[model samples]
Target chain A: MVVQNSKSNILIVEDEKGLRLGTQRLLEEEGYAVSAAENGNEGIKLGTSKEFDIAVIDLRMPDIDGLEVLKEIKNVYPNTVCFIATAFASYETAIQATRIGAYGYIPKPFTPEEFIYQIEQGIKQRELILSAERLKKEREENLFELASEKSRLNAIIKSINEGVLVLNKNGELAYYNYAALKYLNIREINIGENVIDKLPSKIVAVVKTIFSNDTFLLKTYTVQIEIKPNNELILEAACTPVPHPDGSLAGVVVTLGNITEFKKIEVIKSQFVSMVAHEMKTPLAAVQGFLNIIVDDTINVEKEKRKDYLKRSIVRLKSLTDLVNDLLDISRMELRTKHREIENIKVKDILSNVLQMLELEIKKKNITVQKNIEEKLPAIQADQNDITRIISNLLSNAIKYNKENGSIGIKLGSSPNYLILQISDTGIGMKPEERSKLFSEFYRIKNDRTRGISGTGLGLSIVKRIVESYHGKIEVDSQFEVGTTFTINLPINLN
Target chain B: MALIAIIDDDIDILDASSLVLKSKGHDIVTATNTTDGYKIVKERKPNLIILDVMMEEPDDGFYLAQKFRKDGIKIPILMYTSVSKAIGMEFDKSEIVPVDDFVEKPISPEELVEKVENLLHLKEVK
Candidate 1:
């Protein structure tokens, strides 16, 4: 085992040479490393520099007094223990030295045993003080580390993209990050504001439900809200409760995110599927009907008679092929793989061509057609093929679903910024529900069956998509069994 | 003789339709696509046009029907399609398929002749 050094380094400062020498000799014999100082000034200098465990100074010195020296040593080396050893020791002097941080005092004529005892007591007191100082330093370091960690957490909460809010136990806003402020369209800082009073009714209700329970727990609620001064902007937000450290009720922490775009995309996809199915069915049915005519031998009478059945079957078969091609076009457009050829085109020419194409069906139905395209209509810059497809689709649907001998009309005009095209037909109009989903892929009106009209249902969907890609808009007005009018607004100049 | 113009994209359908209409003791003109069908309609001026919804293109027949209306061509049209009855939708009396009548595909020979005769009578009455 290693032995601990009990001996301490002591400095004896006294003006009298004989007493100082005697005291130093006694301390050295007691296993202490002792140093000697002749005056108070020298004692103070030596005491400050050397790592002395204790100092023994005389009450009266030539340069500086013992109490003054004691004050200086205590101030400089607070941990170092001091003892007063003076020949002129009195009750008043001893009290003064002790008050100035002296550890112990011994009269000049004291015996060696008494002197050793006082020095031992001084060393013990110093050990206790040093241990206490080390503990306090460790506690201070821990407190600094905790404060830094809290600041880091606060910074992270503020930087997150999602809105974050913290409310106190009384449902008052305690903390709200920048994202939360923006999401709510709150211009001013709202800390300490009551959440129930400040937030909209829907959100306030959700919070109230979450915090109704006594025990602090994590709970989530969703609510719809309008942000900004504009009520048009809709947002879906989620609120959750945060618990306190003691497991008691703390404030609530809420996180909110926006999800408006997701809902619109889902509606478009469903409509596309239905239109494809409906369009394909019509041609397939015709093919089947023609096949039945050819197979039935009873119907055949002469060469000319037999030829009729074969000819009808062939017409239906060609229609099937056309339907397939149309489906392919739609697929390409949906994937955005097809690039449109843009050019300047005359609106009247396109409208006239479309009308000429439908002449046979119109005449057969005895439907009257009218055109109101102005002669001075300006040329529109657009993808000619896409515009043709758009106009053709609308006109076709109008005629295909119109009353026999009904009127079909077309109007074209141009304003400063836009080219307006309108097509109206005395066809079976659509209900509100049908109108809402008219632009959706594959959505057909419920009443088309009775009229025996056939469509792919992708017409309006394709038209809408093409118009949007060109940064234009389309609108429809229709009433059940009355008529339908489609209005297309296109930019005059392509940007 | 009663003249019927058959417009469809499929050569097979053109052949089959011609055979059916001819067998029914009616004169038939067939066009394999909407462009040719329109030409045939303008020249032949058939009493009735047998239009298919999908021909050379999905909406080709429908477009042809609208064109005829805009050009003031007044002829009775008979629209034939397979999916007409599948979706439970009916054509209104005044709509584009606003033909004298509509016939779903795979029709029997007897029904085809009967519908044709009835439409002819309806035309005479008007």
Candidate 2:
């Protein structure tokens, strides 16, 4: 700490002129920076202004006592090493010097060798003290820097969306961010605590594997962890080793990216694709079978049978065409939304049109239809085509799903702000779970009653989409084997 | 001639399959959905069953098969699935889906006949 080989400054305070000059000359000859003070006051003044690594003070002085001078020097520069020079070698005075922070004393009538040796000892002691002081200051500075850096890192991690955790060389949790805590559903994590003891086994397993294997280090790995019994949390974690100053592995820093949303979307996409394929395949299979039979001449099929098969093929083809058309309508619904052609349209007209379209099916099923429309019903502001589609889809579903001789009820009323249409059917209804997914694309209720009903499953989705676009709401009430009632509330006009 | 039951949601599929199976000199009974399909199987005691996977929903075929097993019905089941192969839904006779075999659809007339014959023969062995 003395900064090896740098000249150490020495202050000699003596009331006697001859001894002070001689001491200064001897120290100067030994390549030390020596300053001479005639009395205790001068020594205190010089010690306060310039830092002297060592101070040699006469025990008895005229102006100020040597003890007082030593005390003042130590107050200003506590690192300065002091020596007491006194001809009077009293036991009490020596004790006083030591109490005043004097390193040691040089006795009177000493040999030149003894005097030089004492001076050398004082300089060496000064170096040791200064070195220790430098080390202490450096240590304080390093600690302050480490604390500031840690807080800065914590601030950065807190602002990011991704969760992060760091483990030290001993596999203890060194740092963790807010997102990490929230992801793990923990309130607080203590530093230097082993994650295996604190975190769930799933995460502990992943972290343990990462630490035990060298190949996993510096590589980004992904794993799906079930943070709870049934809920799965997908995390993509990247681990990198923290290197020490000597280029050794100090710890591993792990960053976790939440990919649960992405996984959910992937599942939804696959299920939708499978549903669409299943929907399309039914009609395709029917058509293929009928066409295959009709084209097969080896089997002695009758003319009437051939005609019937062809007719059924045509029906399957027609449904296929309808499916394609519905698909197109759905695409149009996505793109041409919010571009409704506003016009004054009577709800009755759309209802009549839908009834006319379903006349053949309704009559075939012997279904009785009832209607209750408010007198002088005000025209709702909506696109005629959309209202027609909504009414037609609902009526079609009712007709399709109805029991023979089932009753269909239609009620229309108007409030100040809304045109309400309610349709209830005494038919085969749906399970409660199926009602929630009734509006999802390509979703169809699957049970014994619904098994025979043929539909593209896009009807209600289209109805929901179209109604919502018009700032309207559709509510359904149903019980299995009882009935289903759908209530539509459409805002009359845009304000 | 053996009695075979065909279960599907599409009337066209039921008609077409009945025509083909009956043409093979096999007596055929058909239902358009699982409820009537189950009733037909119970009453008719068909030697074999041709089931569609997506009639009531995606797992209708599997559900019906499990129901048959639960009721101690040991008829050979030939499932018709459009997405079973496309989505790589493996058919495990030993596990989740207990069926004799699977036939991806568009109803290849020849493949249907072949699988039916093989399944009926396999059932006869048991």
Candidate 3:
């Protein structure tokens, strides 16, 4: 990696043949790699290309003057030390040569020893300058490496989800990551300042737990703390000891992970499990009870009565099956529902299909259905099956809950970016408080009238999930004992 | 025959529970939600009320119970909790949830009858 040669090379530029040969031999004898140049031009050429450590030039030459040669050599290879020799004593030339970075001047009638000593001095000066250049280059490379390392470290700190705080051996703040600043709500921080006073009280306690003892050799210690007065946030702080290059304790790195979202998901999952278990058990219990009553020999069992019990068990089992299916749909939607197949579909076509499917129920309920769809409703890009499910659920609920001979109104139109669908039903409406929980999983209105209505209770939740998957909005407007209306706006295009 | 009010969010559960109670030769008054449940208790004043803990709201049963106490209704309340106790959330008789007792959902008919009988007997004594 170092540009070094075994013997230092020297270039001699003298018009006098005898002087040039004599100097070259003397330099060779002194263990130097020597190259002779007859004129100033040749000297300049050899000085740059040969990697010569020093150039000895005569002030007077046939082609180019020694001063001009010195300037050329310095312009090309500024590190090559140069010396000027002249027979005439000229003060002007000496000053000019010195300015061009000449090592020194050699008098024309100099002894061989004096010339050798002057050449040696030039060689020494060249070695000193080259060493200094190498040192400067090394310093610059080191600075670059440090900058790149700092940025890389900063990038790693910014990307991690955990909040990090690093403290030096003196219990001062050495470094804190982006997450640390956000979690601790720190605006500005000074390097090497005491951290305990700066950090929030909750975080300070955890950091103190680690820094209390130098003999605490544990690689990692964790504790849970809560932040309050604004938002209740649970943070898990894990502190790890950083060791110095000599294996002594240097600092501690604490990482804080916000686990509030994870905690919320855990609670929801547990509740879902409990609800599913309770629902399934309800049906199974009913079936078991009916079977037990059917096999009772102590009671006079009529065939028709036994048949009715079996029919009721079948209905309960059917409801249980529907609940299981809805659960499956939910799980499937949770996993990769975003990757559903998209196709352009006419809104009216889907609505007509749903109405046809629910024809028998409408007729049985004696409900008067009215439709007011815009003639040219814009097509939407959606999963066709999901759209069908959304329409079917809304229509089914309308008919099922409507009073006998009640009127149902349906409207479909479009705005600039959304296709709007509204369904109004003169049904058993709900209070304002009940509307909020209407879309929650397995949420069904409970009262004397609705108790006789057979439903899986997951239908509206399914409708909501599907609509949200398409990035659509659903709203409900209801009046107690008056009527209920549902408005859905599906986006005309997916973002 | 003693009049009993059955209140629940799930229609099937209400139907099954009401059937079980009616089969025991007691008259059954049913309300699917808290609003109707409160109305029935005020109008008919059933001998006892069987309330579901989780209706449309997680604390619907507690709210109804508080309301009943505010109205000075001394009728015994049997709360049906579909939530398993294994989950470690407990809500017993309190000022907030003023109920006589709790019955786990998916109840065996015999357990339902026994709890209802005990609650009614305790109410009569009071």
Candidate 4:
């Protein structure tokens, strides 16, 4: 289906006025869009202004000859069909004109039919060259579209996180991406090469299943496999058959997803569940044991001993209640930063309130307090209970861990960007190992020095979480024999 | 009355266990930690040892039990564990933990006595 563009534009160059005018009239009656020039210079100017489909030149001219005009006009529009007409048609000149891309020659003093015939042939030739150019341009555009589509497909495949691989029906490498190479532990691969051998056997097994001879069976297969056993690098490979519309085997597509982090999370969750079980059970067992001994019918238990067991059970149950409360506090902190009643509050006031609440305990231990709080301290945005909880937990620890007549020190001040509070106590601190695990949930120091000290082991964990939720930080520095100090830095003027 | 050594970190557990065994006409010797418990058992040569896997100390019970075996102390150790047996972390008789048996708490007074008597009888038979 070619466009037959019938209207053809023609240009003629001749110095003879009668012949130029006569030829123009003959071509104009033939329905050609004709333009005439007197000499080569005039022809060059007309050629620059208009693009003619066919160009006719007189071989022998006055000043600027036809050869120069043909060369100039052809340079402007390379597909211009150029021809020569002359009375003197020599062999060398003909060869030279043909060398410069002249289509053919027309002898001068020719008949009218001959002139019209040559013009018709040149129009036909011009149409042929234009159609040929249109076909070449269409083919090049189609090729460009194909190349871009392929590269775009390639870019999509490479950027995805899932490892992708495609194999042809013969189990040779059709396509693969960078993630596929890394996931399958492949060093080098080439297209059309057999990739079945390079893959790990677990994945290879799935690929074989897809490529199996059972033509009726079309089902996706998935397998969870450990790629590196020692380090526990694991993956899940999913393979599906790529089928043709004719119910024939085309290829297989395989996708791999990394699941090592999920596996580790499951293990940690189970461990935490067991720890919670153990913590809940230990105190309950003591309380149950206390009751069991008191209630055993076969034993002759005295009233005083029964009373002692009952009292001890109450104490153990109290600690159990504290454990439950602490657990609830931790879960609440984890569940949401929402539902908190936030306000601007002074740390100085909260610290004093906590101290007043703990007055009885502090006085019973004979612990003296030394306070160094800066006046006009900047207010911090936080939940009031959160601040109270932090101060109370740390202060109580100082009181509980301190000896008789021990001193508790408090220093609350503000730096340029942060409100810094440091609380220290003259008490038995911890070893390096103990301090490292101090903030871990359900961790407590257990040795001869800590034999009498009792705790739920969740205090410091809750405190650290509360401080961090407000974009603040808490640090602990403790020496085994000297003392323990806790420092907190809460950001000021932070929304 | 046979002298029995009980090692536990919880003073209440030690007290309850002492009361339970004392009702059985046994002289109870108690230590609140592994070190003192080991010294008391070695010096007093108690006929039976009750070892508690305390929550505060991680893996201290297994270490103490194995240490006793390595030191050639053949006293029958009745371990008290708060970890549930159904949780599938049962402490069985092995070279890693050479204890006589496990007693998942809270052991009823009758069951506690039963396990302690069985282990002591096994010691005597050996």
- Candidate topping DockQ: 4
lDDT of 3 by residue, A1-495 (tens): 122467787889999999989888988998888888999888888876756788888999989899888888888889888989999858887888898888899889888899989977887788789889999999999999999999998999878988988988667988887887777777887778887777666556656766677566757777766654333677777888888878777888889899777766877898888778767776776676667555644334468867877888899899899899888898898886446778999889999999999999999989999999998788999988899989998999998889999989999999999999999999989998889889989778876668667777799999998888888999999988778999999999987
Q: Judged by TM-score, which candidate is best?
A: 4
* Interface RMSD values, listed in order for every candidate: 6.6, 1.7, 4.1, 1.8
**Which stretches of candidate 2 lie above 4 Å from their native place?**
A1-153, A156-161, A168-174, A181-221, A240-251, A295-300, A324-372, A375-384, A402-409, A425-453, A477-484, B33-47, B53-75, B84-90, B95-99, B120-126
Q: How well does candidate 3 score on lDDT at residue B72?
A: 97
Q: After TM-score superposition, what is the CA distance of residue A192 in candidate 2 from its true location, in Å? A: 5.3
Q: What is the alpha-carbon RMSD of candidate 3 to the true structure?
A: 6.6
lDDT of candidate model 4 versus the reference: 0.86
User: Can you write out model 2's per-residue Cα lDDT over A314-390, one digit (the tens) per residue?
Assistant: 77778778788888888787788436788989998889888998999999999999999998888888888899999
Prediction-by-prediction clash tally: 76, 1, 3, 0
Question: Compared with the true structure, what per-residue lDDT tens digits does model 1 show for residues A195-259?
Answer: 66666677778777777877645667788775644444556778777767677767677776765
TM-score for the second chain in candidate 1? 0.84
Using DockQ as the yardstick, the better of models 1 and 2 is 2
Q: Specify the CAPRI tier of model 3.
A: acceptable
Ranking by DockQ: 4, 2, 3, 1
Better of 1 and 4 by DockQ: 4
> Model 4, A28: alpha-carbon shift in Å?
4.7
